[model samples]
Structures are given as structure tokens and as C-alpha cells.
Target: SLKGEARAGVQFVKAQMGAVSPATLLGLGVGAEGDMAERHAHHHHHHEDEDHDHDHDHDDFETFQVDLPALQDADLFLERVKQVIIDHDILRLKGFAQVGSKPMRLVIQAVGPRVDSYFDRPLADLEKGKTKLVVIGQAGLDERAIKAALQS
Candidate 1:
């Protein structure tokens, strides 16, 4: 289902880019790359099962809170997150983005680090797309800078 979703989403984006797709593209998986197609498919299915098994664990948000006092601006906060993404190649990011005048919080979840930044999906919330992210870093993040970034 993840692959299907990814494929459909890719089609949507491609369409936006003025490209059209035949029905055959629907059967192709989007997240899988070249080389280890068989092995990756097998592992990817198993990982999906594991994810379903642990879906409940993800609902708990104990680890989302950040206690750092140094992060004082929203822009700086986003910059730091950008830096983290640049530095770490394996880390996955999922959170919200807020732009000026946008009432909805843009829920953003990026898979992979920096070079492979892929936005996963958007949550259907009523609020102006004001998404929030719980960034994980070795050093504490600046909350104020992050908030300011949203305002700016």
C-alpha cells in the first residue's frame, strides 16, 4: 500500500509538471530503486509488516518534546533542522510547516537525509496548514527561532 500510495503521489506530482501517465505506471513501485529489486521488495514488505505491528508505539508522543532553551527563533529553528538534514543521511523527518497567511499547518514528513529529501504526506487537519516538527538532534534546538521562521 505504501508503494501504491507513493506511485500515485508521484503521478500526481508528475501531472503537475505537465506529464501524463499510462495505467501501466500504476503497477510500478515508486519507492524501490535499481539493483536490489527482489531483495528490496522482500525487505520492504517485511518492514511494512513490522511498521504495522508497531503502529501503536508511534502514536505515543513522549519523545516529541524539546526542552532546549537556546532555540529562540523560528527561522533559526528551521535553519538548524535544515542543517541536521544536511549532516545526517539516514535520519527521517516528519513535522509541520507554517507559512505567513496560511491558516493550515503543512504537515511535512521527509524520509531519508538531505540529498534524498522526500516529503511523505500531508495530514488532513482543519487548522491553517501549520505543521509542527519534533526534530531530533544531538544538540538542543532553538524553539524561538523555529517559531519566528514560521512567522516570517
Candidate 2:
């Protein structure tokens, strides 16, 4: 059921990308529940109140390079994604991600509080106009707003 919900959410995001070729679905694990809280809190700009390990988390992060040769609105896309992440408090996600020019969708997942797996996948593997992501997070989130943010 968790995967189902996640899949549905990812599909919704894919629709926002418009009609593109070669998309992959990835499932990323953010980490334990405690880590999720720490990450979300940090994102809120409450670094002073919380103590998180930044030295090691950076090493653990994986980069996902995407190719948007034809996609002219990259800044807008990044802004929308940032807004969605901030609004939803989503920390970990795992679903199908269609890569660029690749018909196969890889199921990627990750877990951790200090690290973000957003840039871990390769653009060559993502499907153009199809950037779909299904994220799971702790309470204090707005799923509807997140979905809307992704679309807008």
C-alpha cells in the first residue's frame, strides 16, 4: 500500500513534466524517522536549535545529473521542486523514475537525514518532460499543496 500511494504521487508529478521520452521511476530511501525530522527541521532554517552531522552526510550523497537540452525552463523547474520539498516536508522517496532517452524506469530508494538523493540519478536515464517523484515524510506536511506546487 505504501508503494501504491507513492506510485500515485509519482504519476501525478510525471503528468506535470508533459509528454517526453524515456522516463525512469526511482524509489529513494531518506533514512530513519529521526533523520527525517532533523533534515526537515534544518530546511526550516533552524540550524541553531538542532545539531546535525554535516561532515559525513555530504559524502553519502549521490548525484543525479539530468539533461535538459530542449527543456528551456530549468530554473523554474528547480524552484518548483524546492517549493514542493519545503512545503511537503518530504524526506525519503522511492518509486519509478524514467531516465532520459531510456525506456526503462529504475526503482531507486535512499534513507538518511543529512543527505538528499535528488541529484543522485543520471539525466541520461531520465525521460524528458517526465520528472516524477513520490516522497514520504513525517507529519507537518501538506500533500495537496506539494502536488499543486509541482504542477505550477
Candidate 3:
């Protein structure tokens, strides 16, 4: 039967990937969306006493957002962003910015020290001229310093 074959395939995969959590596999969306979240939460609570040792500590990750008025100079804005990335040791940064007199929104993305940006679609009728960004890094990020540096 097809159902039996599918079950066999899943069992084989699980056997090959020993110690893989059901939550991790369900995160791939193999199950219904609503049930996936419930299963994930249950698995999280259940695994607190397990012996798994993660390579990196989840408590060491931190994230923050930066929101400001539309920027006038793209060059100056990018320079400041680069400096912030270097100083803060950012792992990933991404967001959209409204640059001066431009019809389209500027999309910014950075991974490590590499930064990239491009103009996306034109601003909608209700969209305001604003810059919004989300920054992710290891714990101990100076949120105040980062916001001040970017705003200036």
C-alpha cells in the first residue's frame, strides 16, 4: 500500500539520521501547519532534559531593530552601515530604506562584512518615507550605540 510505503520511507530516513528530533523534521512542513506549532512547543518542553549538546548556545543570540526618517544620501548611509557591521560583529542585517527623491524603495541586506542594496518597487500611496532595519548578532550588542551611529 502507498501509505505503508510512505511510512517505511520515513522510518528509513529517521534511522539514517539518528538523534534527529521529530520537531526538527516536522519543521520541514511534513505535517499540517497548525499541528506543527503545537508539536514543536511540546517537543521543546519535553527535550529540556535530553542529552543533546548544541554547538552554539541559543542564549548567545540577540536581535534589535532600527527605525529612522528617510535618508538623503545613500553613500553616507551605506558607510555608516558598514561601520556598524564591523563594530558590532553583525551576523545578518536586512531591511528597506526610502532614499531621498527616489521613486523606488532601497532594499539592504548584509551577511558578515558583505553588504548589498538595490532599488525595489515604487512606494505605495500610504507608505511613508522611512528606514527600517533588523540587526542580528551575538549577545552583548550595544543597541544604543548602533542606533546612534546609524542615525547620525
Candidate 4:
């Protein structure tokens, strides 16, 4: 039986696996003053689910089709993704990776513009053929720039 942190991890996996998602556990670190856990654990904080929730609440989200080069290879894809996360104030980033004979790897990362958090977990396939990434942040994160960054 799972207990303590193990139990929580299992529980989280169960809930996430049930959804059509792909991501293997990457990193999980909640800030000291941050209540990322509380917000996710309770439904009362539904607002937290949003990527952007601040005073500058002017539409702030960009989703681009994962370029062919990025999708064909995992390493290349990850490199571009990390670049985006590091270069931009990405509040949230999540995507599915499907590899033959391997469990789907879902990568969820949050760097800067808010708190730093990351989670990668293996689950069922969600993206059938194409790949996509949804990013939300403040400024310097436009679709064109993101697409260019991703293609490279």
C-alpha cells in the first residue's frame, strides 16, 4: 500500500492517467509561500487552473502545432521546449510525447512569471499523430515567435 508522499504521488497519477494525457513525471517542486498543492488539491480554487490570472488579464495564451522536426525526435523536441521555458516567462507548459512501445510521457513545466513547478508522468496516448504545446505568459510569447522557436 502506498503511504505518505508515495500515496499522494500514486493518487495524483491515478487522477491524471484517467485523463487523455501523456507525460512522465519530470519534476515536482512547490514554492515555500506558494500553495500550488492546495490549489490543485481543492476544487474551491478552480481559478488557479487558468494559466494567466493577474491584473494584466488581457488574453495571454498561444498554442502552436509542434513542428515535424520536433515531433519526429524526442531530444530535439525537448531541447526546443526547454529553450522556450527558459527564454519566456512561461507560467505553464504541458505536452504529450508518444514513443513506440513506450508509455506516453507528459511534460508539465512552469518557470518564471509565477512560481517554478514541473511535472512529468507516463500515461496513455493523448495526441494521436500531431504534437502541440499550449503556453501562457505575459509579453514576448507570441505565436509567430513561439512557432519560430519551436521549429528551430
lDDT of 3 by residue, 54-143 (tens): 334566789999998888998889888988888877788999888997879889998866789998899765445889999998898999
Error of 3 at 85 (Å): 0.6
Clash number for model 3?
A: 0
Tens digits of lDDT, candidate 2, 1-152:
54574522344434454754343334334345547555543245444655754444334333322222322344455455555555455566444444345444444443322223233444453354455555566554466665566556
lDDT on C-alpha atoms for all candidate structures? 0.43, 0.46, 0.78, 0.50
lDDT (C-alpha) at residue 94 in model 2: 45
Model 2: lDDT equals 0.46
lDDT of 1 at 78: 57
Among all candidates shown, the one with the greatest TM-score: 3
* lDDT of predicted model 1: 0.43
Worst 10 residues of 2 by lDDT: 62-71
Every model's TM-score: 0.30, 0.32, 0.63, 0.42
- Position 30, candidate 1: lDDT: 60
lDDT score at residue 103, model 4, on the 0-100 scale: 49
Q: How many steric clashes does model 2 contain?
A: 44
Highest lDDT among the candidates is held by which one?
3
CA deviation > 4 Å runs, candidate 3? 1-56
The digit string of per-residue lDDT tens for model 4 on 72-132 reads 6665566666777566545566555443444454453434322232225554444444455
Against the true structure, candidate 2 reaches a TM-score of 0.32
Q: Which order, best to worst by lDDT?
A: 3, 4, 2, 1
* Candidate 4 wrong stretches, greater than 4 Å: 1-70, 100-105, 112-126
